[model samples]
Target: MKLRLWPDALFGRLALILVIGMFGGQLLTSTIWFETHDHRTLEIPSRIFASRLADTLRLMQDAPDDAARRELAAQLGDDHYTLRWIDGPGVAKAPSVAQRTVENLLGDVLARRLHRQAPLHLMDAELIDDSGRHRGIFSLFDSRMPSGDFHVQVQTPGGAWLDVTGQEGQAGRQSEPRALVIEYLLRIYAIRFVAALLFALVAVRIAVQPLRRLAVAAEALGKNVYRPSLELSGPREVRVAAQSFNAMQQQLIRSIEERTRLLASISHDLRSPLTRLRLRTEMLSDAASRERLSADLDEMDAMVHTTLDFVQGVEITEPRHQIDIDSMLGGLCDDLAETGAKVALEGHAGAPVSGYPRNLKRCLQNLLDNAIRHGGSASVRVQDERESVSIIISDEGPGIEGKDMLERVFEPYFRAQPGKTHGSGLGLTIAKSIAMAHGGTLVLRNRPARGLDAVLSLPRG
Candidate 1:
């Protein structure tokens, strides 16, 4: 599998971007500081040590003899440096890079004090050998201990050699290596880094809260037309988007209400005319023509009534609740059995789904009616999935006999097999509308073995 640096969710993507940006910026600033300021600060310790070395040289030159010089050196010695009198010019071993740099700095300072300079070399001199014997020594070499001595042979004008030695014993914490400085910086600020990351997480969450709430409200709106509109909050952009969405929702609700009211008025007004037409048909003397006219009038009246019912169903305003779909299907089958219909139920829903009880029941009722009407017997099956629930209702009669007629079956007033079934052709249409209103889908397919199957799939939450 390929590695994915980016996530699919908005929250994860935004958080990842924020963390990378913050961490990168911190790293860049620290690198710049270490280069420009941190390394340059190492010169301070070198300058202080150079000044003390020059003082030791000048004081030892005024000593009267070897014993007096040794006494004076002892008096001037400190924890960092131990002054002593020795008889050597310099050490035989070559100086390392670090040792050479220290030697150059001290030689330059001493030459400035003496007012003349050719080349000055400092060497090791064992004067005060009271080296710190740290117990539990772990190093392999005993000669390579922490003990160090600086021996300087200054040629006196009287042709005698003045061996001045200084032993630097104690280690100063200030003169640390570059890597050690970086390590200290990291250890000291590790907690601060964690705290800053936590702060970024919280800030990102607060910034993205509006989008999260908007998504939840949009999903709710898809499931329920009567869901309350979202309140405006958060950033300006998010607030504007929420306002636009709410406006669109209000316009849709208004349009649907207007259409429903108009259709209801038309249905009500035409009822009296349809009744008068039925009464007028009775006055006809021809018996065969009267029966035909009355039948047509009755069919028209039923169509109008079914149309009104469909319109009312579209305006459903039921609240969502946990519904046990299996129990509902069993109850519906029982009711149909009482009505002497061969309607049976199979399978079960393992859990309850959140939905509008009345609207969902009505949708199921229409599907079951279709199954029983088109086919002789109806079998309803409820399937529970991980993310969704399904209801498969099938019948034993012949399936849709005509091609291109399956989708047309859901069109209002467009019956595919006219005169074969007593229906207004609005049953499937209303059922599908209700299913969509509850964030579900209804599909119709012909079963090759027997008849038609209606599948209703609803989301799990």
Candidate 2:
């Protein structure tokens, strides 16, 4: 099995890239926020707690005796801060990792304010609710659960330990770790992911629309050279491409027109001289010489006519429309039957094809004629499909003598049976050209049962 981390389409791939990039940015931002927020949460409370402890210690040191110090400590205690005197060390159990961190920060602050060091031990330091239940300090950051408690014992100069407790609260209702985590996921990850996805889709779609239109225009050009020019209504690059394509189409049209005019001139100039030559041959004294000369002139005339017809078929500018292929094939078979040609038609085209009707008919007629002349009989079959349609014409006589001749037979003036001089040898050449003009293909192959098959495949769209 293979894993595909990337998508194939432009829109999908672009959207994936955008979403991943946004998520990475959000993660970095959250990490920075956590660091700064944690420091602020610890700093402000530590400073206030240290200042009050310094004042209490100084006042206790000035008292007359132990009883007086005890009475003074009890009077100075309040709701947010409390103090108690013990005869021995107050904290016995070891502090946790989080408690140790809090202990060191407060210890340093208190020593600086009092201008002296005292032996200090942290008893407890953790997040808590109003009911005084301990909460994990390593849980997700939430503004709701802002209250916390800090307890520590510090040894005074008189050899007695002073137990100190400080409680702090922020302005919000308390919440649990599970609820905080869910809130953080929804706010930070889910919202950003959905926003990035929508943005990427809209931006990528707008960017790729021009490219899609350009591709469709290029395809239409192949089927019809005279297709309407592309509309220049996109970004600068897209407009430039459309302009270039239109210029190329115009150049092609001009070149074809020039070639057609030249062929027309040549046809006129050559026929008059050939007619004069035929008249001169008819004036010959010997019947054998006259017959031979006339036959040669006739062959020359046939060659000229066939050559012009082939070129005209290729350069035809017929407009495209829906063609009933089955009806056309049936009609051709009936006409050939009346002329004593052994032609058979089978199968129907399930749908109409979009193409030049006259050119397609000419292409099919040429294939049928070639098959009947060489194979003595022709069988036509139509295979309709979703994307394309196929017309297969099979003949039943000795097929092409060699495999190489199958392709060579479509070349102009190249005959498969070299000894036979009946054909002008441009039939298959014209048929192939017509197929290409409609963005279709015409292929010839030899049959296993001693015949030839010409398959013409035309695209549905």
Candidate 3:
């Protein structure tokens, strides 16, 4: 398996970026601080050693003879350093490369303290452990029990040599390098990492909240174009987006209103000519020709009305409210049964659904009318579910002849039984539109046994 170092979510990615940045910054800062601290640790001890050696040399120069000088050296001696009169130089040859560097550092400090350069020889300068064995100079600051041993010889005014042995004590051993590192990791890195993570999560959450709200509003717009506009409260970008969406909705509403008026005008104009034609047909003397023309006129009028209804169903202007599915279905069935049409309803809708009640009823009424007209009977089965509700209206007639006709029936002016004289062929088209307006679906399928089943499914929310 391959490793996935990057996260998918915006919050996760932001948090990871912040945490890594903080860790890198802390590492860089700690590195610089450790370097500076190490240099100071070495410099402070060197200065102290130099000052003490300078004072000792001054005392030895004032001594009367060898015995007095030896007595004075013993008096100046302490746990940190020991001084003695030597017959020859303490270090026979010159100091090595590492020792030379340290000797020069000490010599410069001693000269400044004494106000003149002193003839000095460095024999050994090294870090040591408790066993008195030498350790590498690089481990001086990091070592747990760090100590220093120094051997030096200085020439007096009389050309005699004085040997000094100095030792660094274990006063600062409690603050070990390992303990310092652990403290730095906890106090600096760990604390900051957690703080960065929380900050990133909260910041990203707040920033993305507006986007989530906008998405929800866009989805709802399809169901109801006149739903309340989004509240403009957030960053500038979010506010701008909300304003644009509201403008778009207003534009859609205006366009739909214009189309409705245009259709209404055309219907009115067509009806006036149709009315005149019907009046002129009434004056015809031949009875057979009059009846045929009257029937044609009636069909044309019905087609005009059905076409208008189809267009109106495409965009329902009514506001949504709670609808009792059971009550509505029962009423439609009762009305049809009263007219001697076979209609039956089975199953109950446990809860009311939110939708345009008139449009929903019209959709159901059209499906029932089609079933009764073609199949001689209609049976509706309501299936209520968690997210949506399904109303299955079945008929006992011979189902659509061809598989293609099942879908083609939903198209405007496309009738399954083309020779039928009653319908304007826009009933199924209008019903499908109403179903879509309520964020639902209307589909027709052939029953396993016989007849066609029209299933209308509407979302609960």
Instruction: Give the lowest summed-lDDT range of ten residues in model 3.
Output: 35-44
C-alpha lDDT of candidate 1 relative to the true structure = 0.71
TM-scores for the candidates? 0.62, 0.66, 0.65
* CA error at residue 138 for candidate 3, angstroms: 13
| Residue range 281-389, candidate 1, lDDT tens digits | 9999999999999988888878778878998876667677999988888888999999999987778888898888887888998888888887877998888898889
Among all windows of 10 consecutive residues in model 2, the one with the lowest summed lDDT is 135-144
Give one digit per residue, the lDDT tens place, for model 3 in 96-152: 555666688889987887788998888877666555666544454466665667788
**What tens digits encode model 2's per-residue C-alpha lDDT throughout 142-231?**
345555577878876577888889876643434465665776688777887888888888888898788789888888777667777889
How many pairs of residues collide in each model?
1, 0, 0
* Higher-ranked by lDDT: 1 or 2: 2
Local distance difference test, each candidate: 0.71, 0.79, 0.81
Tell me the spans in candidate 3 whose CA falls farther than 4 Å from its real position: 1-195, 276-300, 400-408, 420-422
TM-score of 1: 0.62
| Candidate 3's TM-score | 0.65
Model 1, residue 118: displacement in angstroms? 22
lDDT score, candidate 2, position 44: 53
Q: Give the candidate number with the greatest TM-score.
A: 2
